[model samples]
Target: MRLIFGLLYTLFFLGCLTTALFVVFHLLRYSLDRKVAVFGTVFFLSVFVILLFTNALIFFTLPLESLFPTFNTL
Candidate 1:
Protein backbone atom coordinates (compact mmCIF):
# COMPACT_ATOMS: atom_id res chain seq x y z
CA MET A 1 0.00 0.00 0.00
CA ARG A 2 2.80 2.40 0.89
CA LEU A 3 4.63 1.60 -2.30
CA ILE A 4 1.45 1.99 -4.29
CA PHE A 5 0.89 5.54 -3.15
CA GLY A 6 4.51 6.43 -3.82
CA LEU A 7 4.29 5.09 -7.36
CA LEU A 8 1.03 6.91 -7.97
CA TYR A 9 2.51 10.14 -6.68
CA THR A 10 5.50 9.87 -8.99
CA LEU A 11 3.19 9.17 -11.92
CA PHE A 12 1.13 12.22 -11.03
CA PHE A 13 4.21 14.40 -11.00
CA LEU A 14 5.32 13.13 -14.37
CA GLY A 15 1.86 13.70 -15.76
CA CYS A 16 1.92 17.29 -14.57
CA LEU A 17 5.33 17.81 -16.17
CA THR A 18 4.11 16.37 -19.45
CA THR A 19 1.04 18.59 -19.43
CA ALA A 20 3.19 21.61 -18.67
CA LEU A 21 5.42 20.80 -21.61
CA PHE A 22 2.42 20.84 -23.93
CA VAL A 23 1.26 24.14 -22.52
CA VAL A 24 4.70 25.64 -23.05
CA PHE A 25 4.82 24.30 -26.55
CA HIS A 26 1.54 25.92 -27.45
CA LEU A 27 2.48 29.18 -25.81
CA LEU A 28 5.64 29.42 -27.87
CA ARG A 29 4.32 27.94 -31.07
CA TYR A 30 1.02 29.79 -31.51
CA SER A 31 1.71 33.17 -29.99
CA LEU A 32 1.71 36.13 -32.36
CA ASP A 33 3.82 38.28 -30.08
CA ARG A 34 7.25 37.06 -29.02
CA LYS A 35 7.34 39.16 -25.83
CA VAL A 36 4.01 37.80 -24.63
CA ALA A 37 5.10 34.25 -25.27
CA VAL A 38 8.35 34.76 -23.43
CA PHE A 39 6.70 36.42 -20.47
CA GLY A 40 3.98 33.83 -20.23
CA THR A 41 6.47 31.01 -20.40
CA VAL A 42 8.60 32.52 -17.67
CA PHE A 43 5.67 33.25 -15.36
CA PHE A 44 4.03 29.91 -15.89
CA LEU A 45 7.24 28.01 -15.33
CA SER A 46 8.16 29.99 -12.23
CA VAL A 47 4.82 29.35 -10.58
CA PHE A 48 4.72 25.73 -11.65
CA VAL A 49 8.19 25.06 -10.26
CA ILE A 50 7.40 26.74 -6.96
CA LEU A 51 4.15 24.83 -6.50
CA LEU A 52 5.77 21.54 -7.48
CA PHE A 53 8.62 22.10 -5.03
CA THR A 54 6.30 23.05 -2.20
CA ASN A 55 4.09 20.04 -2.85
CA ALA A 56 7.10 17.71 -2.74
CA LEU A 57 8.25 19.22 0.55
CA ILE A 58 4.85 18.81 2.13
CA PHE A 59 4.28 15.29 0.81
CA PHE A 60 7.68 14.06 1.98
CA THR A 61 7.16 15.53 5.46
CA LEU A 62 3.85 13.74 5.94
CA PRO A 63 3.86 10.99 8.58
CA LEU A 64 3.36 8.16 6.13
CA GLU A 65 4.43 5.54 8.63
CA SER A 66 1.53 6.45 10.89
CA LEU A 67 -0.83 6.98 8.02
CA PHE A 68 -0.08 3.57 6.59
CA PRO A 69 1.33 1.62 9.45
CA THR A 70 2.68 -1.87 8.85
CA PHE A 71 1.85 -4.87 10.99
CA ASN A 72 3.21 -8.31 11.73
CA THR A 73 1.31 -11.26 10.37
CA LEU A 74 1.43 -15.02 10.78
Candidate 2:
Protein backbone atom coordinates (compact mmCIF):
# COMPACT_ATOMS: atom_id res chain seq x y z
CA MET A 1 0.00 0.00 0.00
CA ARG A 2 2.68 2.43 0.97
CA LEU A 3 4.78 1.50 -2.03
CA ILE A 4 1.88 1.98 -4.43
CA PHE A 5 1.00 5.40 -3.06
CA GLY A 6 4.66 6.35 -3.05
CA LEU A 7 5.07 5.46 -6.70
CA LEU A 8 1.94 7.37 -7.71
CA TYR A 9 3.04 10.45 -5.77
CA THR A 10 6.49 10.30 -7.32
CA LEU A 11 5.13 9.99 -10.82
CA PHE A 12 2.67 12.85 -10.33
CA PHE A 13 5.35 15.25 -9.12
CA LEU A 14 7.84 14.16 -11.76
CA GLY A 15 5.31 14.65 -14.53
CA CYS A 16 4.60 18.18 -13.36
CA LEU A 17 8.31 18.93 -13.08
CA THR A 18 9.02 17.54 -16.54
CA THR A 19 6.31 19.68 -18.13
CA ALA A 20 7.65 22.80 -16.37
CA LEU A 21 11.20 22.11 -17.53
CA PHE A 22 10.03 21.59 -21.09
CA VAL A 23 8.32 24.97 -21.11
CA VAL A 24 11.41 26.62 -19.67
CA PHE A 25 13.59 24.97 -22.31
CA HIS A 26 11.37 26.28 -25.09
CA LEU A 27 11.34 29.78 -23.61
CA LEU A 28 15.15 29.85 -23.33
CA ARG A 29 15.62 28.48 -26.82
CA TYR A 30 13.19 30.95 -28.34
CA SER A 31 14.95 33.81 -26.57
CA LEU A 32 18.26 32.73 -28.10
CA ASP A 33 16.87 32.45 -31.63
CA ARG A 34 17.70 35.61 -33.55
CA LYS A 35 15.06 34.89 -36.20
CA VAL A 36 12.43 33.08 -34.20
CA ALA A 37 10.21 31.06 -36.47
CA VAL A 38 6.69 32.46 -36.67
CA PHE A 39 4.96 29.12 -36.28
CA GLY A 40 7.00 28.30 -33.20
CA THR A 41 4.81 30.47 -31.03
CA VAL A 42 1.63 28.73 -32.14
CA PHE A 43 3.17 25.32 -31.73
CA PHE A 44 4.56 26.13 -28.33
CA LEU A 45 1.24 27.43 -27.08
CA SER A 46 -0.59 24.38 -28.37
CA VAL A 47 1.84 22.06 -26.64
CA PHE A 48 1.60 24.03 -23.42
CA VAL A 49 -2.18 23.82 -23.43
CA ILE A 50 -2.14 20.13 -24.13
CA LEU A 51 0.38 19.43 -21.39
CA LEU A 52 -1.44 21.61 -18.89
CA PHE A 53 -4.74 19.86 -19.50
CA THR A 54 -3.12 16.45 -19.36
CA ASN A 55 -1.45 17.18 -16.03
CA ALA A 56 -4.66 18.53 -14.58
CA LEU A 57 -6.58 15.42 -15.60
CA ILE A 58 -3.89 13.11 -14.27
CA PHE A 59 -3.78 14.86 -10.92
CA PHE A 60 -7.54 14.88 -10.59
CA THR A 61 -8.35 11.40 -11.84
CA LEU A 62 -5.70 9.33 -10.12
CA PRO A 63 -7.37 6.37 -8.39
CA LEU A 64 -6.73 6.55 -4.69
CA GLU A 65 -7.90 3.02 -4.19
CA SER A 66 -5.17 1.69 -6.41
CA LEU A 67 -2.60 3.56 -4.38
CA PHE A 68 -4.12 3.17 -0.93
CA PRO A 69 -6.48 0.25 -0.58
CA THR A 70 -7.19 1.19 3.01
CA PHE A 71 -8.32 4.67 2.11
CA ASN A 72 -10.84 3.58 -0.48
CA THR A 73 -13.35 5.75 1.34
CA LEU A 74 -13.59 8.04 -1.59
Candidate 3:
Protein backbone atom coordinates (compact mmCIF):
# COMPACT_ATOMS: atom_id res chain seq x y z
CA MET A 1 0.00 0.00 0.00
CA ARG A 2 2.76 2.40 0.90
CA LEU A 3 4.64 1.43 -2.24
CA ILE A 4 1.64 2.19 -4.41
CA PHE A 5 1.12 5.59 -2.83
CA GLY A 6 4.83 6.40 -3.24
CA LEU A 7 4.71 5.44 -6.89
CA LEU A 8 1.63 7.52 -7.48
CA TYR A 9 3.19 10.53 -5.79
CA THR A 10 6.32 10.22 -7.89
CA LEU A 11 4.26 10.00 -11.05
CA PHE A 12 2.22 13.02 -10.09
CA PHE A 13 5.33 15.11 -9.44
CA LEU A 14 6.85 14.10 -12.77
CA GLY A 15 3.62 14.88 -14.59
CA CYS A 16 3.59 18.40 -13.15
CA LEU A 17 7.21 18.93 -14.18
CA THR A 18 6.49 17.70 -17.70
CA THR A 19 3.51 20.04 -17.95
CA ALA A 20 5.62 23.01 -16.84
CA LEU A 21 8.25 22.16 -19.44
CA PHE A 22 5.63 21.97 -22.17
CA VAL A 23 4.23 25.34 -21.17
CA VAL A 24 7.69 26.88 -21.30
CA PHE A 25 8.36 25.33 -24.67
CA HIS A 26 5.14 26.64 -26.15
CA LEU A 27 5.70 30.11 -24.73
CA LEU A 28 9.15 30.29 -26.22
CA ARG A 29 8.09 28.86 -29.55
CA TYR A 30 4.95 30.93 -30.11
CA SER A 31 5.85 34.31 -28.67
CA LEU A 32 7.07 37.03 -31.06
CA ASP A 33 9.35 39.03 -28.74
CA ARG A 34 12.40 37.04 -27.70
CA LYS A 35 13.06 38.97 -24.48
CA VAL A 36 9.48 38.87 -23.37
CA ALA A 37 9.20 35.19 -24.20
CA VAL A 38 12.25 34.28 -22.14
CA PHE A 39 11.19 36.47 -19.23
CA GLY A 40 7.67 35.11 -19.21
CA THR A 41 8.81 31.53 -19.40
CA VAL A 42 11.26 31.96 -16.54
CA PHE A 43 8.79 33.80 -14.35
CA PHE A 44 6.00 31.32 -14.98
CA LEU A 45 8.18 28.30 -14.41
CA SER A 46 9.63 29.70 -11.19
CA VAL A 47 6.20 30.43 -9.76
CA PHE A 48 4.93 27.04 -10.83
CA VAL A 49 7.86 25.25 -9.27
CA ILE A 50 7.39 27.12 -6.01
CA LEU A 51 3.69 26.34 -5.86
CA LEU A 52 4.29 22.69 -6.70
CA PHE A 53 6.82 22.31 -3.94
CA THR A 54 4.55 24.02 -1.45
CA ASN A 55 1.71 21.65 -2.32
CA ALA A 56 3.93 18.61 -1.95
CA LEU A 57 5.14 19.85 1.39
CA ILE A 58 1.62 20.35 2.62
CA PHE A 59 0.54 16.93 1.40
CA PHE A 60 3.36 15.22 3.19
CA THR A 61 3.02 17.23 6.36
CA LEU A 62 -0.72 16.91 6.72
CA PRO A 63 -2.00 14.63 9.49
CA LEU A 64 -4.20 12.17 7.71
CA GLU A 65 -5.19 10.31 10.85
CA SER A 66 -7.18 13.26 12.07
CA LEU A 67 -9.13 13.52 8.84
CA PHE A 68 -9.66 9.81 8.12
CA PRO A 69 -9.34 7.74 11.24
CA THR A 70 -11.09 4.78 9.61
CA PHE A 71 -8.23 4.24 7.24
CA ASN A 72 -6.06 3.19 10.17
CA THR A 73 -8.01 -0.06 10.43
CA LEU A 74 -7.07 -1.07 6.92
Number of the top-ranking candidate, with TM-score as the measure:
1
Lowest summed lDDT window (length 10), candidate 2: 33-42
TM-score of 1: 0.86
Candidate 3 lDDT tens digits, 1-74: 44555588889999999998899999999999999999999899889989999988987876777776776678
Alpha-carbon lDDT, every model: 0.88, 0.68, 0.85
| CA deviation > 4 Å runs, candidate 3 | 1-5
How many backbone clashes does every candidate have?
0, 0, 0
A best-first ranking of the candidates according to their TM-score comes to 1, 3, 2
Estimate the overall C-alpha local distance difference test score of candidate 3: 0.85
RMSD, one per candidate, in order = 2.4, 5.3, 1.9
Span of ten consecutive residues with least summed lDDT in model 3: 1-10
TM-score of each: 0.86, 0.43, 0.78
lDDT tens digits, residue span 12-66, model 2 = 7678768766776676576666446435655776787698778767756767667
Best by lDDT: 1
Q: Which model, 1 or 3, shows the larger TM-score? A: 1
